[model samples]
Target: MRLRKPKKEWRHRKQRRVRITAMIRKELDWIVHDKISMFILFFLPIFLIISVGNVEFNIDSRAQDTVVYVIDLDSSEYSLDYIETIRGENFTFTVYDNHENPDLVTMENAEALIPTTELGAYLIIPSNFSETLLENQTAKIDLYIDGINTIEMLVIKYQFISANLLYQVEYQVFNSEVLYIPEYRPEIDRSILENAVPNMIPTILYAVSNMVACQAIVADDPLKRMLLSPTRKGEVIQAKTFAYIFFGALLSLVCMCVLTFGFGIYFISPLDTFLIFWMTTIFGVTFGLFFSSLASSRLQGAQLFLFSFIFQQMLVNNLRIEPIVNYMPIEVIRQNITDIVYRGIPFLSLGNQIALIAGMNLVALGAAWLSLSLKKEVA
Candidate 1:
């Protein structure tokens, strides 16, 4: 039995170019000739594999634990018991002089301590709290949380609320009374937990856009590349995008791993997370290509990439549907992408974000093809 010679037909050629993951991996393997490692090879050498301390989820790492200053005006057995139980993950209880008399809490005092000391959360165990809790009357507690610190502090706040409720439940239980645990989790429709997947497909579209490929396909020095004609402009563009998809995926994977294991954020489904990350990455690549295509010089591409970094860091801040949309030149960027008005999980409805991202990709790809076509012809 013998194999036939290559057909070299158009159909065969189309079938042959069906970019495979294994091939992409192999191409990346060749990127760092000797080192052939995954993320380190694609982006930079793994400089700090050994972090000074534990890795963090969000960019700014929190302290080992958040300290809760309990001005317990009551200091009752029940309150004291509750305080002891708070030592686990989110809350570390530090008793101030006045935890027993929460009624005496001044408005100014509450404002100063809760926000200034970087506290995770603050709570008042009212004088009426114990009696109302025991007399089968509904009790209310006031908590002040720091809103500036996004997910990490938010997680601690949720935990504190849960722990507080648990203390109430135990209060009723010991007093031979019954109280229903209030079950309100804001429906979590698209809260931070679900957001672990992705707010929008920024990373996915970023990979597809393939900006890293720009570096790989450039003719080294522009003057030298003008002397060659063996490669088509289209082929060069394709190869560069391929390289970006490879690199972007690597950076994103590291980010997800750090968020998951290093931080306690749970992913309901890895597949969903992967999709969201890859899509957003493709978005980044698309923006990169758009920059590369338009710039007269490669240095311009680097400058534009920096500009994009600034814009993307603030994407969700400025670009979102909200109750009150107001932003100054810098106020626009104070928030972040996740904070943007992505009402709920994206793509659940399957049109707007996907379309928006795809539209962006079309603009990028079109520009890339057009400009590269002209440059190739000129060469």
Candidate 2:
């Protein structure tokens, strides 16, 4: 009886192993049959690596025309030399003599010029600049940069610093005198972490939610079987979407807590910030679902989501078009988040941004529903 029982156990174990092996084989076959998915899954990383590796990072190669307004209070030969040193092929310096136009020395005048002339920065050379440099002391220069675009501000700053370094080197060689030009950005008060974290939160949340939800419907093999029953297609999609949204809300909360406690970042209005985060997650999920419904396989869905995300990021950030940048999904979320978190602007004031996000969500959700309704088998 013991020997017969051992044989029965062995047979059961063998059958279970066979069933698992068959399932694995079936999945392999499915993957092999889907050539497009296989290609994307295998070659996409290599393609991305090669493409990114070929990008140019040299700032000099991509230098754009920058206009700087110089407020020269010194009116000395040394000050003129300093200005000439900083000016390059790409940099156009508009020198404003503080003596001729006493009003130009005021911060109000500088601020006014930025809007009207689209000025990049203001270089204020102190009256005692030449005297201090001649006495072998470090002279300070006030650099009031247009802080609206961080990238442009940085480029202008680095270019100035680089040119200043060359001037110092040349002066030391000729006169054996020490010179210094310390940059001061009065416009920007916040630290790099404070300025960057708020902008990054929405983007990170959107990316994670989109990636996870992209495979929600199209990759779900059991969804087809479920649809065979009395379960409505809308119910399945709704349940899946709601499940992801709940998970996304929890994720958003965790991210907020980490930003607040772990990173010591404070939100002006926690409730409004949380609401925005939740809304961003919903949009991400819906956007992913729109792509997932359009795609035939999990890999295809993921690829579609990736392409869309990359395209929008490039369009919004690099495209100099005002209308497109204002209306892009990522840009809208980022701008509103920046306003609420950093500027302390109330959520109610951002009705336009909220409405645009809501409208986009509706369009995406409708498209996903339509796609699913039109096609019987999603997978």
Candidate 3:
């Protein structure tokens, strides 16, 4: 009787394994056939890497003509010489005399001009600038910059500082006296693409995984019929989750390789970075599955995914409430990516982040399982 019971149990276990494998294969087939899914999973990352990496944001001779507005309050020879010395082929300077346009330096005028005109930056040479400098004292030049584009702002600021340094050197040579100018130069060693691509990895993985997985159960019309044939909802959900996660890992690998080999963006710990990306994919898939289970139709699932994505992005990027933002899932992922990729922090050092992500994944997976289990029919 014991031997017969063991044989029956073994047969049941084999049958379950076959069922799971079949379900996983079915899910993979669906992804391969779906045009949108294929693009998001395989092609989107490559496209983004190529398009974003090729952009040039360096402050060099290749800089496009930048229009700078100057309100020269000190119309002295020294100020004029300073202006001329700072001029570059890439800069088109428009000098406004204080007597001609006294209101140009006003806060209201600056606010209006910077936004409305093609003004890259507005400079004000103080009336006492020449007097102070002649007296062997440091003079301050008030610079109001249009900070809409960060790269452009940095470039403009760099050009101004470089020119000012040259002017100071000329002054020292002409007077044969030591004149001190307090310098403020920010260290910008990496290009824009180098800094941006690392931050983008987690976001891209999360977004694509979430987007594709949101339609997993809701869009599969055969799921309802399958459930009637000894296939439990939990098994179905598990199969779909496994399949999506497998593909998500592959997508993450492809993205990292493209950015590293194709674009020369290096990761300090490639293995650790890839692990974090894979974890992000797991979180994204489970989160989407929870929503997909809640949704009644494919359209509703898509809407939920879009709304969730936008809301998360706004919170992570724009929200200033630090206490709340710190615990948010996307924000945590972003911070960890920065730590691992940019700061070279080890993956195990981010214990809190990894734990939170794991906890969130479990909660999402549990919620999805419950939702699917309770549903009368999954359509």
Model 2, span 1-379: residue lDDT tens: 3544345442465654544444445444554565553454334423432333333333433335555667888889888888777764434344454455676545667768775435667778999999988886778998887777777777777778777778778666235544655676555555444666556667667876787678777887866875674455555556556666665676677767766665467787888888888888888888988888888998898899889888877887777488878887778888778878766788778888788888998898888888998986767
Residues 32-69 of candidate 1: C-alpha lDDT, one tens digit per residue: 55342233323331222213112334323353355555
Off by over 4 Å in 1: 1-30, 33-76, 85-90, 94-163, 173-194, 204-219, 243-283, 296-299, 309-317, 321-363, 373-379
Relative to the true structure, candidate 3 reaches a TM of 0.68
How many steric overlaps does candidate 1 have? 34
Q: Tell me the alpha-carbon RMSD of every candidate.
A: 11.0, 15.6, 7.4
What local lDDT does model 1 show for residue 172? 45
Candidate 1's error at 188, in angstroms? 10
lDDT of each: 0.50, 0.69, 0.79
How many clashes in each structure? 34, 0, 0
**How do all the candidates rank in terms of lDDT, highest first?**
3, 2, 1
List TM-scores for all candidates, in order: 0.49, 0.54, 0.68
Please tell me which model should have the higher TM-score, number 1 or number 3.
Answer: 3
